[model samples]
Target: MTTEANSKSEEGHDPFFDHVPERRGTHSLKWDKYQDPYVLPFWVADMDFRSPPEVIEAVKQAGAFGNFGYGKPSPKLVDTVIQRMQERYDWTIEPSWIVWLPGMVCAFNLALRTHGQPGDEVLSAVPVYPPFLTAPANFEQKLVKVPLILDGERWTLDFDALEEAVTARCKTLLFCHPHNPVGTVFTREELQRLADFCLRHDILVCSDEIHCEMILDEDSKHYPLASINPEIADRTITLMAPSKTFNLPGFGCSFAIISNSELRARYKKARAGIVPDPPAMGLTLAEVVYLHGEPWRKRLMNYLRSNRELAYERLNEMPGLQAFRNAATYLTWIDARKLEVENPCRFFEKHGVGLSDGSDFGTPGYLRLNLGCTRSLLEEGLDRMEAAVNSL
Candidate 1:
């Protein structure tokens, strides 16, 4: 038997995540960006784990058929998305509400372009993903950053501050569910307040929910901003993907769900000419992951829970550091202000680990650590972090 076949069908133990693939020469954005053999990159969000077995098998099957041409989304794909949403979130969605796209970042830019006129303002809470910071400027819209208050334990949205910052020129609130970096899954009450704020201001909400499926807390639930009610639904645009959940990001499939006909028409119009359809392989793998990857997803979450615990434990033990114990997402944020360091990102990189610089995410003196890698690598990165912070 071939070595590849052997890797797939090995007996006794699971073969999927047993080894980390050598990604140095693989054109990996995460690996290539650092360019140093010495740096253990925990900066970028992509997982070092292999794509789910179902995804691999489906892509291979599609490639073997050899009919890559102009394509349409499968009815199965739409129905599977509907079924999964209802089953998991108790949220109902119509097939007509789905608009497939190549990436969630595209959805952000589309939302801004479709909703914001020049000089109009777009608001997002700070310490967020980098794309959220830049998307507003891409279309000449004003960007407003409302800081998230750090409660004794977790990050909380300062709704009073958020409401005060809204002005007549503001057109949309670009919200993140299971927020990145800080990883707070906004509670139903928090989301309800957010919904009311938007509805009262008559502002449309574009919620990026890419990490919705990866909630770490078993008790916490992700409520789609639109799923709260019809009033919010008519003004909400939600973006989600299986890429983050099933480690299929490289396959490039994401979608925006817009329930309002006017909003959907605007989004589809903005997407024309510039946005291309997802690759044939992306569609095939997407369908497979949604329908058949749930068992693998459960395994991933259970394993990631351990990694998260190890990270939080280590960070809490160190002096001058307090890691946010997040309820969702594999990413966590740390406040390093107590360390009095000039640059925490560089300090960690100097110790042979790379992390997302907080300043880039609109919060200084804080860093975002990605916990989606192998347990061994997580140990190494954590060790480096401990040594680096201990030195200061």
Candidate 2:
């Protein structure tokens, strides 16, 4: 399991060749599910790239030590999380405040089961990740969707509409910070406004900040919703994971920061027997990466920034395609409303590119593209997209 870093180049090397291995026949969601050889799969949020060299090395080191059993997270791993939070977001967190989970999706499901009743309404913004809408349903909770306003090329919340949507039936408000499928790293002001509104209505906020570390814009910063105000902190469940940042989703390691003691108790009570612990290897790698992989992460971020630029320029050139430049995450939300095709993903699949359908994300006539790939694969996907759009 030798790992190599891409040599820094002027125009950037192909990320597909540089980072991602050909994932065919590997049971990879991003690759295996799409059997069409021509369809360049970019549906799942996971990158087509490999994890950082240091991360791979760390995982290898852990694997070399042959001990596989039920394990508790090491104190070092807990400390690593605390340090990363302080360094990255300037948010201080105690070890006791951290509640470990197998995955962020699990955290979402647990949140609904913990706080809301079977028929209580769970609210979230539209054009978000599919799980945000489906999580509530899993627990038989009603889901209330508030559509985000697309003002020009940016997606923003209509606070007035959101206020109208929040009612006695709505007990929880799930937020996607640095929103998935629509790449908007919310401003601090916007976050404050949201916090204020939720506080006034006494609605508990569950924020998923899993993509907090992949921010591409230098001017943009990620603000944890709980850090905005004490009231918000008392009522918020901040979900985060190393999966998205370190490309370790397969490892199944995620945690929630529950600031308020009562809220923590309730969340823990819901998981008294059901929620399984994160894998020992995942915790080991998470600890090692946090301690020694900062330099590698810096280099990776630089590479992703370049990829984001390349995708932005290439997609903008297509006739009926439009993409909003994102602040964080390798996933890019594309506006394909102008296209004549009924199903954008299917249309792209015909052209040898597979994209996540926007309708699944609660926004039709749009598509989401994963930019976490080798430059060659990205270019090929873009070229296919151009040909498809041209033929239209």
Candidate 3:
């Protein structure tokens, strides 16, 4: 079915524009935690919208069978993944390379333990996802951060700075593609340069491409780090999942594509006795979404592009706010430096709008805003932000 078929109209049926019931009272991280009556949460990465009809239906069909034993990923699940890779990125992936995991965070920890030694350095570009900073330390490795350069409002990697940060002690590089917080989708040339650098330093690369399917620009294509070159693929572990794409994160299913057999063996060894198989329902829905939800996803991207436009236009009109236009992901990175507030998070909190603190992502004086909400909800948040900024 087309995404338009899924959408609801103002007077009739427009699922995309409608307000759906949020599972808040049942331990929802986005809604239940924010208790203040006036506070509007634009903080978390998850969307406020409901899952697509196709995904929900798939899960329901699986529930009908009532066989929830110790889960094993079905051959259908592997086929779905292979089909998606071939269709979306023009990259073919062998089923043997897929390593099932309960979540991407677990995979990150496993990669760190497998690739690096104690006191060895793990390099990543910041401001990045918080786990990228903490995961290395959790494995008894040092975290080396290289800041992304601000070209006007755009965030791009500083290659020279990154190369300088990589030393003999650095063993692995963790990369977030279609990056979190500041969303910058790396170009092919950029990925090639990164691969060259990693090859020169003999550093293994772990690429988190969970946001690869959520592209805002029709012209922009996500290049898997492993697919860039044979050398890089041999040294890379590429992680992806339907959780982010189909809003199935609660389902607890993510997989890593390991091209090199030796590297895969080491990774599996580190994860032994630790990582368990993904849930049966997760595998079920993952297969269903890959086969039936492509049209819905295309429409979701279109809707998200509209949301991004609305946010950018509205945010720029505010006196002291500057939002970086993102090419992918539903998150917008806004610079609030002009507000003159020493603590921007505290400043926004006082105004009843909770935003992710830029400091948390290693970039001060900026805030990340999740724009994946109904237009009315977004407008309410934007209004609160304007009041807060004006009061300052």
Model 1, residue 340: distance off in Å is 3.5
TM-score of each: 0.94, 0.96, 0.95
As a TM-score, model 1 comes out at 0.94
Candidate 3 on 31-114: residue-level lDDT in tens? 766777577778888887777777777767767977777778888778888877888678888989999999999998899999
Q: After TM-score superposition, what is the CA distance of residue 58 in candidate 2 from its true location, in Å?
A: 2.6
Query: In every candidate, how many clashes are there?
Result: 0, 3, 7
Kindly state the number of residue pairs that clash in model 2.
3
Computed on alpha carbons, the lDDT of every model, listed in order, comes to 0.85, 0.85, 0.85
Candidate 2 lDDT at 104 equals 94
Q: Positional deviation of 128 in candidate 1, in angstroms?
A: 0.7
After TM-score superposition, the amount by which residue 279's alpha carbon in candidate 3 deviates from its true location, in angstroms, is 0.9
| Candidate 3 lDDT score relative to the true structure | 0.85
Clashing pairs in 1: none
